[model samples]
Target: MKVSMQISFNLDIINKCVCHKCPVQNQSECVRTQMAGLKTSFREIPLNPHKIPKAYCLNGKSVCKGIDRSKPCICGSCEIYAKHQLSEAEPGGFYCIEGKSA
Candidate 1:
């Protein structure tokens, strides 16, 4: 299931995202910096231009190498996840690793 960049980049979605709070996220400094950039001035930038781990629903796979795959995913709890009914999509949950919903 491919989601639009507009819907994925929506502030409401980003704000409600639980990726930053996930245990899988704590190991990556890149994720931290990317999260900070999104919170600061990069919020309006397209997900592809940010060079970050955000908006995986639209941006697909993460470039950051530090992520731990063993940790559980929190995408199931995300507002965007529910709003888009992502559970019906293939390779849905681990956007951080498996990439986008489809």
Candidate 2:
């Protein structure tokens, strides 16, 4: 199960994720702090949801607090959304709080 979860969290998914730019987590100090450390993350190994707070839809709901859900979710425009056909999924796109794209 861990292997499958890790496999789901890949460099390709991370690179394509727009969570870093999303307004939902814009004010999250935790996300910002993690984002700062991401400069060397691509070259490093062993990534987890908290280690790299991206691709929430694929990696599951966020562990960080203070996510502003009042803002609109842009998951529909995401490559991961399209690739996964997330339009039909429940909660549509707010994967950050709604959990993975179920």
lDDT of 2 at 73: 82
Model 1 residue 80 CA deviation (Å) reads: 1.1
**Per-residue accuracy of model 2 over 1-102 as CA lDDT, tens digit each:** 111222378889888888888899878887788888887765667765666878887767888888899987877778877766677766567888898765
What candidate 1 gets wrong by more than 4 Å, as runs, is 1-8, 39-49
Give candidate 2 regions above 4 Å deviation: 1-7
Clashes of each: 0, 0
lDDT of residue 40 for candidate 2: 71
| Cα lDDT, all candidates | 0.71, 0.76
Name the best candidate (by lDDT): 2
Report the C-alpha displacement of residue 15, candidate 1, in angstroms: 1.1
lDDT for model 1 = 0.71
Worst 10 residues of 1 by lDDT: 41-50
**For candidate 1, what is the total of clashing residue pairs?**
0
